[model samples]
Target: MPDKQFAPGCGLVGTVKLLDIGVPTTNLGAVRCGEARAYAFWARNAVAPAAYQILGSELAKIESMGSYSCRNTVGTSGPVRLSGHATANAIDIGGFVLKDGRRITVLNDWASADPALRQFWDVIRRSACRRFGTVLTPDYNAAHRNHLHLEDDKAGFCR
Candidate 1:
């Protein structure tokens, strides 16, 4: 079933309905198994806002790198360890596709993307760090060489 939550009094926003909140979570110590209010709120406020502003009023869909992976960080060859996602404390954003049939992939587009697209992407990436406890980008490491990793890490690391 989908888990719907409100994004609070963020600037122009509505309820975020995460369809297929899918999979029961056993790693985050019973945070209701899906996106917690804070994470949802952060994503909506941090990422969604920029989506509309940057995608230009013609936004189509937001592509997700993925969420809720029951594994360890990439290149960690081992028995699956807990990922930030396991705690519902992380979100992986890959890219965006506009209504004009344009495919903007994070890996390829971030550097050479049009000025507007690059601005939009950078805005959101920086915004995520400002809003979330931790934000990882392609520059962070090979594990996240393609997507933005937004997490509510109490350590206050923004790399």
Candidate 2:
């Protein structure tokens, strides 16, 4: 989809395409992101592979809060700045669904008692960090206690 210009210095910089991230999403249906970057390739090659490696079952769908928000960065106390979402270059992952109908949510599974569950989250986070420029998990702060913020901004900040 074409980028919509909201105002001066505030809008997507490139075509916003629906990413076929190799897995469907529960809420997002189609992962819409900037086409100027390799976010889709990273999701399909890096993120999906890592997830399938540990899931042991067929991965069904990803769960996302949404993307492409026209807003500033949250959880920061300094001067406000446009967020990756402003340009559709970021995605917020909230959870996952297995083919067997099992669901894993970051809010509940990130600190799950099951070792395997914890390991799954760890592996996914690490894998995303390898591709996305900025990966923020529940461990980053309270604001992210329910989702993993993945951005392709070349910031290289992961937590």
Writing each residue's lDDT as its tens digit, candidate 2 over 1-159 gives 555688554565554555455667544422244322455665566556656676666777778887777788998888988877777777888887878788889998898988778778777787778778899999999999999998877788999
Clashes in model 1: which pairs? none
How many steric overlaps are in each model, in order? 0, 0
Candidate 1: residue 49 Cα off by (Å) = 4.1
Off by over 4 Å in 1: 1-17, 20-39, 42-49, 75-81
User: What is the C-alpha local distance difference test score of each model?
Assistant: 0.58, 0.73
Question: Compared with the true structure, what per-residue lDDT tens digits does model 1 show for residues 46-67?
Answer: 4555656776644455666655
